[model samples]
Target: MNKILIIGAQGMLGQELLKIFPQAVGWDREEIDITDEKQVKQKIIDFKPTIIINAAAYNAVDACEQAAEFELAKKINGCALGYLADVCLTLNATLVHYSTNYVFAGDKKDGYQESEPPNPVNKYGQSKLLGEREILRRSNLKYYLIRTSKLFGAKGKSTMAKENFFAKMLILSTKQIELRVVDDELSNFTYAPDLAQATNILWQESHASGIYHLVNANPRTWYEGARALFDILGKKVKLIPVAADEFSRPAKRPKYGTLLNTKFPKLRDYEEALEEYLKDRN
Candidate 1:
């Protein structure tokens, strides 16, 4: 069995990776801190892993809004990636990393494709994209960069862009819970376990490389997803859907950030994936 090291082991996706990688072996932050390159290098040297999955990320979306914290965010999101790539290269191990669809220009007449050039709308996405480029450019280690969207899990509900829009509508026990979900912002929600399984399978197969879009099969608006969320929770609420123009934020978002999974259609649609996720959660 191949030994695997997973950074960000306590995170939603990292936890999923631990469950999926029968060969996956590594720390839970109680064991290591990925942001520390010295520790990362020492751990890799000791584990002598065949595969390295980096799930560490500074994922707080609005945290990037502050100018003072941008550098720290870059260290966690980008520089750490570069360090991981370097360590993986030294060990001659396959390195797997996660990225977001946020890296793209975000405004495409058609949904963004892996082939499309990246133009991040925010500092967080920009840092991640930079990490992607740095890893590819600097490392000789075999690598897989899987770009995912709108991740949700059973743990603490965090606002990973569109998670709450749907989760919020689910708890609408009252007619007072009116949600003004943005119709203009397009997306596909990816469940973590599904993503982890698909990713490791692709990696294990030995032909997976370059950027692959690993999102749920269907494209949707936030309002539709929220309605689905409420429906799944066995609740009925008057969801007051609104346009993206109605809501304003510090960072600009791609009006149509839908990613098309031309490479991995066998993965199933967003609805099917969500159905499985809901079933597990319940």
Candidate 2:
């Protein structure tokens, strides 16, 4: 039997991964500090897992622009992977990690493919790219680097969890009759459950270790996504589409960061996934 271990088990995607791989041992930051090399090695060595899935990430994109937060993000999203990969290489464990679409420069209007080179526009993206290089640079390392975007589903149980875009829109709907959302930036909206299932498929099929883009089919702007959410909920909130510059953000976001899934069979469309999410949430 292949023993599997899931780090960041309490996270949004991690929670869904646990359901997909029920036999896998799950660990949150409380169990093992991935940033601590000694602790990370000891924990994985003790578990002796054949596969290691890392779902933890420093996801505060805007905050990463600050020097202090950038360092923390780099440590968690970048250096922490080095720690995990060191152990995976030592144990010959297949390492599965998630990355963001933000790694791309976002100039391509058509969206990004798995083969495209990454040029991050922000500190968060920089940190994630660092982690990707750590895994890829190791020629002997067996790893899966999945790049996804705009994830939504159940909020994570961890304190570090932030409400996803859809959740935030829902809350704003209750408070305000009208809302302004950015329409210029484009990216796919991924459902956490769908992503988890796809990750399991990759592992179960023993797919080759390489970069993969896993996200819902359609690429839409944040404004479009909000419109879809309100439509699905049958809410009457007025949504105004505005340019990205209207709101001041600490981190500079790419105009287009959609992760085009050209590797595995395409997952269901975002609208379908969003509907399922609404049902599940209710």
What are the per-residue Cα lDDT tens digits for candidate 2 across 64-137?
A: 99999999999999999999999999999899999999898889998888999999999999999999999998
Compared with the true structure, all predictions reach lDDT values of: 0.76, 0.93
TM-score leader: 2
Where does the lowest 10-residue lDDT sum fall in candidate 1? 156-165
> What is candidate 1's local distance difference test score?
0.76
**lDDT tens readout by residue for model 1, 1-282:** 677888777677877887887566746656876678899788779878878888878766667867866777788778888888888788888888899988987778589878888999888788888888877796356888889888876553223323333454555545465667777778778888888888877886786667788887677888888778767667767777797767766667777788877776456777777777778867
In candidate 2 the C-alpha lDDT for residue 39 amounts to: 89
TM-score of 1: 0.91
List the candidate 1 regions with Cα displacement exceeding 4 Å: 156-165, 172-176
lDDT of 1 at 128: 83
TM-score (C-alpha) between model 2 and the true structure: 0.99
* Cα TM-score per model: 0.91, 0.99
